[model samples]
Target chain A: MSERLTPHAPLTPAVLAILLSLAEDEKHGYAIMKDAVKPEFGGITLGPGTLYGTIDRLLRDRMIEETGTTDNERRRYYRLTSQGLKTVSAEIARLNAAVAQGRALGLIQPKGAR
Target chain B: MSERLTPHAPLTPAVLAILLSLAEDEKHGYAIMKDAVKPEFGGITLGPGTLYGTIDRLLRDRMIEETGTTDNERRRYYRLTSQGLKTVSAEIARLNAAVAQGRALGLIQPKGAR
Candidate 1:
């Protein structure tokens, strides 16, 4: 695993989005890209360079791994590891806590309460 | 304002935390640092270098601005501009949407149902 990420280190938004995309099932690069650009995810359009670069980094950090099963010979599928799951989970909790604080401070409205 | 941040650019976790911290009241650097290291905020310990560096960048970008009121001559207080408020609100919304997707996919449990 890459030493760049400590156990509790916060993730970049791009990295977090990619992990969220693969949280459910293994997916090819193209599929991950499609999921990332959804309007809810901020409509972030990752170019091939940004997408693959993040993939490589995540792989190096053992946050994600290439799966043996591939529907297409040319496409490689990737899935989150146990570590990745834990990381994303922690991140989500942190975000939730921050949002809660925002609401308490009146900086953000509660869901369906806007 | 610095040209570095686009209206829709995703923020770094540290930057986001700072914005969220100032969402309510204007605070000094030390106060911001204290809020940022809370357990719910991920306990991210920021040394003076990292804290001031991010503050400088945020000031340049107009995401935060120095307030004229100072409790101490040595400490400078900061508050979020309209731009900062909008940016952090958008980020929280994006994160909430991502969490919803994760829950729908069974990757994350619904709040209080975990």
Candidate 2:
């Protein structure tokens, strides 16, 4: 990612939401789950096992790291890495440019229209 | 997603690469596959059925439309929609901002650093 040396990795929204939440500040596992799932998924929630499962994968991929910060005694905190941001940035840039180009062509329109 | 009153839909990069390739100009199914898969996924090319499966879904969602722009007798061209751009824009924004924020926090660093 970028000019920095980083390993290749891909993460979906569910995993991304967790990283973004921690980007502001390191947070415990439960807090991350709360922030990520709030309003976006409504009543739906990622089980503790699923949340940690993704976290472990992110950790293994070097997307996130464990931090001392936490709000729960029973939970650990996590945060993003430099490579993580770079990867995220590249992914976003790839997407943003595409979207921008599409808008330039006036492709984004009402379903009935197109 | 960006308050455009567009419908909610999530498409994978495989699907997105297809749209981005078509963003510049319309191309038929096989052409889209060639443009998207080239140098990206390497030898792993998406089958016609898979390409159309996503295309049909995107078509139904209005992320793409048959542009009457085509280069193959057995295929058809496609282009993006305004709603698609908005959706793509929002998704990229979501990712970029997160990446930016993580960098700001210095969370993005080497694996051993954190």
* lDDT (tens digit, per residue) of candidate 2 on A1-114: 375354543345566566667666677778778876553322125678878898898799888888776556787877778766666555444443444444454545422464
Candidate 1 at A97: error in angstroms? 0.9
Worst 10 residues of 2 chain B by lDDT: B36-45
Interface RMSD after interface superposition, each candidate: 2.3, 6.9
lDDT of 1: 0.79
lDDT of 2 by residue, B16-65 (tens): 56665666566777778887655332222677887889889889878888
In model 2, what is the error at residue B44, expressed in angstroms? 12
The native-contact fractions of the candidates, in order shown, are: 0.39, 0.07
Error of 2 at B70 (Å): 4.6
Per-model TM values vs. the true structure? 0.88, 0.58
On a 0 to 100 scale, what is the lDDT of residue A24 in model 2?
Answer: 66
